[model samples]
Target: MEALDSPKLDEHSQALVAMNEVFQRQRKDYLANPYPDYTSRIRDLRKLAQLVQDHKDALARAISEDYGNRSVDETLFAEILPVLEGIQETIKHLRKWMRPERRRVRQLVYPLASNRLIAQPLGVVGVIVPWNFPINLAFSPLTSIFAAGNRALVKMSDRSPRLAAFLKRVVTDYFPREKLAFIDDGHQLGPEFSALPFDHLLFTGSTQTGKAVMASAATNLTPVTLELGGKSPAVVAPDFPLEVAAERILFWKLMNAGQICTNIDYLFLPESKVREFVELTQKIAHQRYPDLQAPDYTSIIDDRSYQRLWDTVADAQQKGTQVVNVFPGNEGDGALRKFPLHLLIEPNDDSLVMQREIFGPLLPIKTYRDPQEVIEYINSRERPLAFYPFTRNKSLRDLYLQRVMSGGACVNNCLLHVAQHDLPFGGVGHSGIGHYHGKEGFINFSKLRPVHYQGFIDGLKPLMPPYGEKSRKILEFMIRRARS
Candidate 1:
C-alpha cells in the first residue's frame, strides 16, 4: 500500500535548493548573532511553542486518521505534553546550561593560561520522525535544538502525512521557512533528506534505516542522533507480581499496537514460573481488550506491518510452537489484517518468533533458569534501545543494573525511564548513538568549545622565547611538577 504524503511537498530537487538556501542564510544569521544571545532565540521558541499548543487538537486528529485507529488520549499525554514540557524545562534551564564552563589551568602555563569551556550552537539541525509517536519523537529533539539555540528543518514521515500537514501548518505559521521548515514526502526523499549538511542530525526509526541515515549524514560529517530500534527485551523475576507485571507490560506492550520503538519486543521469564506468568498475561490481555482487533484497538501501522505480524505468527505455528488464543477466534484466517492476539509459545529458541523482533502484539515467552542466565541472554544479543525488568527487589534490581547495560532501563517497570524528563535517554550498542532528553539532549545538539584565555607573567613568557637552557630547564621542571 502507498504511504500517505502531502501534495504540497517540494520535489526532491526543489527541496534541496530550498534547504541549501536556508542553511546558508541561517548560518550567516546565526554567525551575525551568536546563539548565546537569548532575545531572538527565546522569542522564536515561545512562538514555536504557542504554535504547537494552539494546534494540539488538529495534530491529534490527523494522527488518528493516519494510524487508522490511534489513541488520541495517549498521543496527548505521550506526545504533546512531552513537547511542551520540554520547551518549559529548557526555557527554565537554558541560561545556566549555556553558561561557559571553567577549567583548571595547567602547571606548564599556570600563571599565563586561563581555561574555559564555551557552549556554541551547532548550526542547522535536521530531525526526521517516525510514524509511531510522531509528535513526541519529532519535537523531542527540538527541545535540545532550541536549548542550544539552533535553527532546524524537520521531515515528518510520509506514512503520517495528515499529521505532517498539521505540523507543517503550525510550524510555518510561527517560523520562517529558513529558520524552521517541514518537508513531507515518502521513500523518494529519504536519501536526499539525509544528505543535507546540517551541523547535526537526529533520525528516529528502525536500526536498518538508521544506518542509512548515518551514512548519508557522514557525507557532511554531521553528528547524528540515531534513535534506532532493536528487539528491546523485558525480564520478569520469579519474585515479581505475575498478574501486575503481565498487566502493566501487556498494557504498554500493546500501546500503539506494539509499534513503539521503546516497546518491549520480547520477554524472558523466570524458568520455574513461566507457566504462571503466561497464564496471567493471557487472562489480563483478554479481560482488558476482549475485542483485540476492533476499530478501537490499534491496527498494524500499515499492510507491510500487518503481514509481518502475520508472518511471525504463521512461522511459529508451522514450527510446532503452541499459539494460544485466549479470546475465542482471536486468531483469524490470515486474510484480514485483524489476524489475532498470539500468545505464541516458543519452547525452543530456534522458532521464528525467537529469531527476530516481534513488533506486533505477539508475545513470545523465553524462559531462563539462573539470574546470570538472564544477564547472559541479554549480553548475547545486540544492546536494546530500552531494557525492562519488573521486580521490586532492590538487590536484584541493583545487580541487573550494574551487570546489564542498555540505552536506558527501568527496574520495577518498562519504558517509563524514557518518560522521566530528568534522565538522559539513549541506547548503548545496537540501539542508538548519543543521548537526548534532559541535560544530554542539550549537549547532543551543541558544540562544546574548549577555550583557554592566556596572558603571561614575564617568567612564563620566557618559555616561549628562543630555545635556551633556561627555557628548557623551566619546561622540564613544569612537566615534572605537573606529572607529580
Candidate 2:
C-alpha cells in the first residue's frame, strides 16, 4: 500500500481516505455498541503482542536506518520492549479495567443503587507520534486506546522516513487498514489529520508543533492530549546519595542522546553538594559505560537536532560559561554533534543555556544553597511536563512534591515514572496539556458517561408539596448536616 496517497496537502492521502472509510464502518459498530467489551479488546491486544514480537527485527532495523546507526539493542530496549510491556500489562487487567465502578447514592435514592461511571470508548482517535522512539511512542498509548476499544489513525514521524516505510508495511499486513492506519509524509497531512472529527486526539512532539496542533484541533472542538517538551529540572538536596543520583541522571539524560520529552532537562544542586555530585558522575561515566560510543547509547535523531544542540553549547561558550565534558574526545566542533554529551555550568540566569528547554545531551548545573529559591525558579517558568528530585530523604522529596506543580513526578530516579502502568503520564502549563496512560490513559480516550437510574417509587415527594411536618424535619436535618 502506498504510504502517502495524497499528492498535495489540499488533496488528502488514499491511505487516509481508506482510513475515513474504515471509520465510517467502525463508527456504525461503535454507535450500535458504545459500551466497551473487555474480552474482544483483549483478543486484539494479543494480536498486537504477536505483531511486536514477530516484527522485532524489522522494527529495530528500520529505527536504526532512521538514526543512521542507532544500535538495535537501543531500539529493542527503548521502543519494542516498552510497547510489548504496556500491551501485556493492559491485557492482564482488561476485565477489571472495563467493569463499571459502583458509587453509593445519596439518601434520596435509597435502595436504588448507582453505578458511578461507565467508561465508554470514543468513536475514533488520532495519535500524532514523535520520531524519537517511533514504535514505542506510537503503540504505548495505543494500547490504552485498544484497551478502551477505540479505532486509531496514527501519524508516523516524517523524520523517521525509513521506519515509516517499514511500519506502514507491518500495519497493513496485520490489521485492516481502517481498524489501524499509519501516515508517513513530511508533516504535510498533519493538519488534516488533527482536524478530523476524532473523539479525542493525542500529540507527542515538540512544543512549537504542539501549539499548531492545538489550533487545528480547536476547529472541531476536539479534546486533545499534548505531551510536549519542557525544561524539566532534576534537583538533589544535600541529603540524597551523590553516586546514585549521578548515575541515575546520566542514564536518562543520555538516553536516546537526550531526545526524550521527560528527560532531565537540567539540574539544581545545593552549593555545598555541587562538586561532590559532579565528580561522582564523572567517575561513574568511566566505570559503568567505559566507552561513550557504547552500543547501549543511541545517537541524536537527526542532523538538525544535532546542530541545534551544538548551537546551545556555542552560545553558552560565547557568554563565558564553563561546559562540563562528560565524554572524552566529545569536544570542539568536529566531533561534538557526532557524539554529544556535556555537563554545563552557567554564571547565572542570564547565561544562554539556562534560558529554555535544552533538548539535547547537555546537562546544565546550578548551585543553590536555598531549595526555596530553586522552587521559585521552577514556578517562574511555565509549569513543566515532568519533574524529578533524586532524594532518599522523605521530607525532601515530599517538600518538592508539595510545593512544585508538574505533569508527573519521580523520586530518587527519572523516566521510570512514565513506564509504571499504574500511573498517568501527561504535562502541565506550556509543557503540554492532558495525560493518558494506564487507567487514566483509558479514560482520556473514553467518555465517562453517568447514567442515573430512578426506580418506580416516587418516595420523598413530600418536599415538592406545601411544607408539612416530615418535609420540614427532613429539610432542617439536611441543612444541619451540610453545615456540620
Candidate 3:
C-alpha cells in the first residue's frame, strides 16, 4: 500500500519540482536584469510574432485537433490573426508606454523639485490559459508582460493537450526557459500553478474556477486579473432592423460554437419582434452553417461540455421553454462531439439555461416590452462581462450605455470592442477585475513608481521644528495661499 501511494506522490512532487524550478529561474533572471531596454523588448515581441507566423498552420491544426474539429478559419480569424495584430500594435506603442511621465510639481517647490512616474516591470507573471482561444489568451497577456519587461510562466489547459504539447516543444527555440516557459496542466497542476508566488497572475476561465484561483493567489498576496465569464446579453431595440441584429448576434453566437466568454449568452428582443427575430435568426443560422458536421462548424470542447449543453436544452424544455434547433435535421455527430446551435425561447430564471453562463451554442432569449424592463432585469443580476444594445437612436444608446454597467460594451455590434487594440478590455464585479489591453495592459503588468527630486534649497526649512513668531507667520501665509 505504501509503495503504491509513493509513486502517485512522487509524480505530483515531480510536477511541483519542475514548476518551482522554472519559476525560480525566471525570478532570478528578472532580478538580475530588472529592466530590459527598448531594443531587447522589441526583439522579444518580434520573436513572439515570428514564432506564431512560422507555426500558424501547425498551431491552427493543433487547436483543431484539440477541439476534435475546430474550424481552421475560425482558429486563424479568432485566435491567430488577432494576436498577431495585437503584437504589432504593442510594438508600435511600447516606446511611448515605457517613457517616464513628468508630473507637475506643486507651486511651493515648482522651480527645482521635479516629479516623475516611471512604468517599471513587476518581476515574473503567471498566466492561466483556458482551452478556448488558447493561443490568443496566452500570447496577448504575454505581449503585455514582455512589453513591460517581465518574464512569464503560462499554464495551459488540460483540455488542450495537443496545443499545449506543441507550444511546449516550440517555445524554447524562440525564448530561453529562464525568460519564458509553458507549463502543461496534464498533471492537474492548475492549483499548484496559481499557488506559486508570482508578481501578477492573469486567468481567463469560468467564474467559479476564478474564485479558487484568486483564493490561492491571495496566500502570496499576488495581484490577479481574472477574465471570467457571465451571462452577457444583447438587446435589439425596436428601431433596429431585426434582420441585421440576427445576423450579427448569430455570427458571434455560433462562432467557435459560441464558446467565447464575451459571446451573447442571452438576448432581449422587443415583445412584438420575438417571432420575426427568431425566424430571422433561424434563417441566418441555416445559411451560415448548412452542415453541423462540416469542418466549418466547431465541435464542443469535450464530452462533459457537450453533455452539459444537451442537459441545458433538456432542462429548458422540461421547464416548458421553447427550444429551437437553429439547423434543423442536423443533430450533429455525437461521436465527434459536434453540437448544433440551440435557441431557448423564454427560458425561466430558475432553469439551468438561464441560471448559468451558457458557454456553448445555446442562446436563451427573453422578450422585453420596454427598455427599463431590459435594464432592470439585467441590473438585478451580476454585472456581465459584456452588454450589446443595438440602436441607431443616440438617446437610446446613451441611456443603455449609462444605465447598463458591464466589463465592456459594444453599441451597435458584438465582440468588436474586444478586437480594437487601443481599447482596454476587462470586467466589473462578478464578470472580472482589472483592465488589460493597450496602455492599460502595459500599466497593469508594470509598477508606476513615483520619484521626487529634491530642490537645491529646502522649502520646508522655514517651517522646521522651532515654533516662533516668524514660523507662525510663514504657516499662516502658507495656509492662506493653499486656500486661495
* lDDT by residue (tens digit), candidate 3, 1-484: 3433465567767777888988999999998999999999999999999999999999999999999999999989988898999999999999999999999987583458999999999999999999999999999999999999999999999999999999999999999998999988889999989999999999999999999999999999999999998999999999998898888888899899999999998999888898897788888887888778789989999999999989988999999999988778877678888888888889999999889888889989899889999999999999999999999999999999999999999988899999999999999999998988889999999999999898887887777887799889988988899999
Model number with the top TM-score:
3
The pairs that clash in candidate 1 are 407-427
Worst 10 residues of 1 by lDDT: 1-10
Query: Tens digit of lDDT per residue, candidate 1, span 48-68?
Result: 678769988988888888877
The true-versus-predicted C-alpha distance at residue 430 of model 3, in Å, is: 0.5
Model 1 ranges off by over 4 Å: 1-12, 15-25, 293-296, 332-340, 347-350, 456-459
Point out the worst 10-residue segment of candidate 2 by lDDT: 331-340
Residue 329 C-alpha lDDT in model 3: 80
Candidate 2 C-alpha lDDT tens digits along 1-484: 3434445533445655655666576666667767657777887788778888998998888887787667687688778887888888887777887888887677562445454788888878889988888888888878988888887778888788888877778776677665677778654667778887888899998888999999999999999999998788889878777777888898888777777888898799877777776688778766755665555666676778777777888788888778777766655233323455788774457665677677677888887888798899888888888899877778777889999998888888998888887888888878888877678888888888787666566556767778789898888987888899
* Cα lDDT, all candidates: 0.78, 0.78, 0.92
Task: Write down the lDDT that model 3 would get.
Answer: 0.92
Residue pairs of candidate 3 with colliding backbone atoms: none
RMSD of each: 3.9, 3.2, 2.4
TM-score of every prediction relative to native: 0.92, 0.89, 0.97
